[model samples]
Target: MATTEAVKAKTLLGECAAEFAGTFILILFGCGVVAQVVAGGIGDHDSIAWAWGLGVTMGIYVAGRMTGAHLNPAVTIALAAFRGFSWRKVLPYSLAQFLGAFLAALVVRWNYTEALNKFDPGLTRKSQIVFSTLPGNGSTELGVHLWGGFRDQIIGTAILMLLILAITDLRNTAPAANLAPFIVGLVVVGIGMAWGTNAGYAINPARDFGPRLASFLTGYGGAFKDQWGDLYFWVPIVAPILGALLGALLYDLLVGRFLPISDEDEEPGRIPEENTSA
Candidate 1:
């Protein structure tokens, strides 16, 4: 039994490593594109959108088999809630993911320091969009509203989680031949095109918080305190987690009941029953 416990620990370490690498790849491309496009003014929204979509796609392809490639903390928690993923690994998985995104953001800052300095004279909120998301319509409405940003984030993340479940639901028209990740990437693209502008469509907590923390440490200075000065940083983190959970539970209740037990690896990231409280 001691030997078995040791092996399990080793397996978990490997899983954490896989999550870290996948999230590193995710931030590398996703933040890289945004930095280049926004700070350098060399690309457009289309480029930014495609870059993140491809980032997620490649990340999944790299780590899907090993750790289920949950590069987002929201994804990790949602899996634990509904899919019987081990709750014991949640903190480890989130830490690995946050580290990956944080490290990748540092690389992105290094690569674009010159451009950033040139474009952003004060390195203030004007330059933060490259690293952290802020609401575009934070003060706009039929008149002037403040909570629109939160609503936008919730909606965008909900859409993201909904598509993630739909595309991977094996009992549904789930893609085969290892194409699920590719399809998932397209769903990301669709979300960006549809609602990305609202609050930068930060559907992943690690994807935003890690980079935001990195930005604060590097130059942004009090990154959570607000690029605009209102300290709305909590919106992205809380909203995405809530949205992912809601999306997953909604899908499971409405659609999962009709579907048969999945034998495929892409069964919404569920762990074996023996491994879970189920």
Candidate 2:
């Protein structure tokens, strides 16, 4: 019995490792595609968007069984907040996720160092490493961008949370599980195509901060120090958290309460059972 229990523990550890690796690969490829599109000059908007979408779809399908493919911290947080994911596990899961993303960003930097240097040698080290906001003009212009970014992220995350809840509900189990990846990928694609220009569509705080930190470490330039001040830095982090929470709350209000199933359907005696053959 002790041996059997040890084996199970090892298996769980292996699963966690796989989850970390899968998420790292997902971010590397997905965000790598973005870097390539913007810096490599190889593809148009449609192509770049499709690359991100397909990357996400494939990654989720591969990692879903292991770690629930929560490549985004916002998604994980939202799930824990609204769904029943154990609160104890949320911090570890999020930490691993953020680390995976950071590693992925480092890999992206290594892979494209030459290209990045060639395209914009003057680009700050931080800018070269990952994504973040640089001061465009002054407080007024920055405010507009921040507001727009905040609004778009709120709307997009809200919709995504709703979709997640609907698809994951046990009553609609099969379809929900089967198509969740595809639906999520498509939502990402739409967001990238629509709101990417404004805010880079950083719907996930980990996605932004992981790469940003990696950029800071690489020393490509001083983009982080010079451009990404505290005010700008915190907006992406705080806004998304608020947005995701709001979205989940809105979804719960709409579907969980206002449209809850009639008492008759949920009554203990009314549920239909499957027929069996003799």
Candidate 3:
């Protein structure tokens, strides 16, 4: 039994590592596309959006079996808080995700140094830097951008979380298994179309912070810290948690409450049969 438990522990560790690697790839490819397209490089809006969407779809499918593909720390925290996941697992999962994202950004920098240098040789110091929002005009204008961006992220994340909870239901789990990646990708696409202009549609904190940190370290000579004063970083981090909680609670009230079993799909309890033998 002890040996079996040890093996299980090793398996979990492997799963965690895979999750981190998968998430890192997702961000590197997805955000790398954005940097190429939007940050004064060669790509276009449609191309960048498609890249991000495809990256997310593929990442979820690749990592779903192992870590539930929770590349987003907000998703991990919300699940642990509301879905009876062990809280103890949340920190390690979040840490792994952040590390993966940071490493991925580094990879993006290594790959794109030439393009970045060509685009802005004067700003070549900003090469490995991933994209995030800065005040487009000035501090007064920043408020409007932040509000709109926060609202969009909140709504988009709420819908995504709602879909996640519904898909994970035992009765619905099969369909969710088939549709989860597509649904998630579509959600990202919509957010990009609608909100990408303002705050870069950073619906996931790990997605933003990890790459931001990576860009800071490898390129831009650590200029990523300059954007930290925008006073809205918390929106990306906090609003997603609120949105996820809202989604899980709303899903529970609407669908979960009506189900025979409140939790997993094993049914509430078993009935005992009486024996008639003398």
Candidate 4:
């Protein structure tokens, strides 16, 4: 007979584990590409965008069945607020995602220590870009301030959340043949290409903050603050959460509420099998 503790572990605990693993894979590949671009002198911005998209796809596949792969805190929060996802699970899911991201960033930093040293011996703010986002991409002349960065994150994340809901809603024209994860990945790619310049499009709070915290702990003195001596850590975190809420609200108000109802439609907050991975 299985122990109650064991059964419990296989339920919510297992879901949390899946979330952690999925996010670990996500940041592993996502930050790995950034490390390659910044430290290895290989690949361009487009390559980074593609790799990050692929990472998200793989992460979804990894945890979709177990926990719907809410690899982002913003995603988790949005789903809870709008999609009827269990509010109780939100904090656990977000914590798992953040821990996964943080560990993955630490691994990336460990793996690329040599390259980082060679690229930026002093571990300057330029080097920190590998681990976290920077305003105007650290360009002093670009004049991208905190407010602009916050706005960019909000717009980008709102778009992301809106599309996520659209793509997963069974009543909507979602992709067929279990390809929702791929399509969702492509959405990230599009966002990266279209809106990545300002603050690196850190539309996902965990995606930005986890590695950022890792960078701060790992001796990136400017990780918490930009070169301009301004504390910049809160922009990515707060903006994305608000953006996700806004996006979910917009979707519900403009699209979801208007969708034709049918018995075949999944319950609110319960994603179907095809898009469960997204």
> Which candidate leads in lDDT?
4
- C-alpha positional error of residue 60 in candidate 1 after TM-score superposition, expressed in Å: 0.4
Off by over 4 Å in 3: 1-5, 39-41, 122-129, 133-148, 173-177, 221-234, 259-278
Which runs of model 2 end up more than 4 angstroms from their true locations? 1-15, 125-143, 172-177, 223-230, 258-278
Q: Write the per-residue lDDT of candidate 3 for residues 1-278, one digit (tens) a residue.
A: 89866766676576568678768778877878866774556778777777888878887877776666777777777777666555666777778888888788778767777776677665432433244433221224355555665676677677767777776566655354377677777767766676665556666777777776666565455344333344554566666777777777787788877866643352101111121000
> Please, what is the whole-model Cα lDDT of each candidate in the order they appear?
0.81, 0.62, 0.64, 0.87
> Which pairs of residues clash in candidate 3, taking residues 3 or more apart in a chain or in different chains?
125-220, 126-220
Q: Which lDDT value does model 1 have at 161? A: 78
Candidate 1 matches the true fold with a TM-score of: 0.92
Candidate 3 lDDT at 266 equals 26
Ranking by TM-score: 4, 1, 3, 2
In candidate 2 the C-alpha lDDT for residue 215 amounts to 73
- Over 106-167, each residue of candidate 2 has an lDDT whose tens digit, in order, gives 89888988877777676553234234433331233455455665676677666666666655
- Which residue runs of candidate 1 sit more than 4 Å off their true CA positions? 137-146, 262-266, 271-278
Pick by lDDT: 1 or 2, better one:
1
Candidate 3: worst-modelled 10 consecutive residues by lDDT = 269-278
Q: RMSDs, each prediction?
A: 2.6, 6.9, 7.1, 3.1
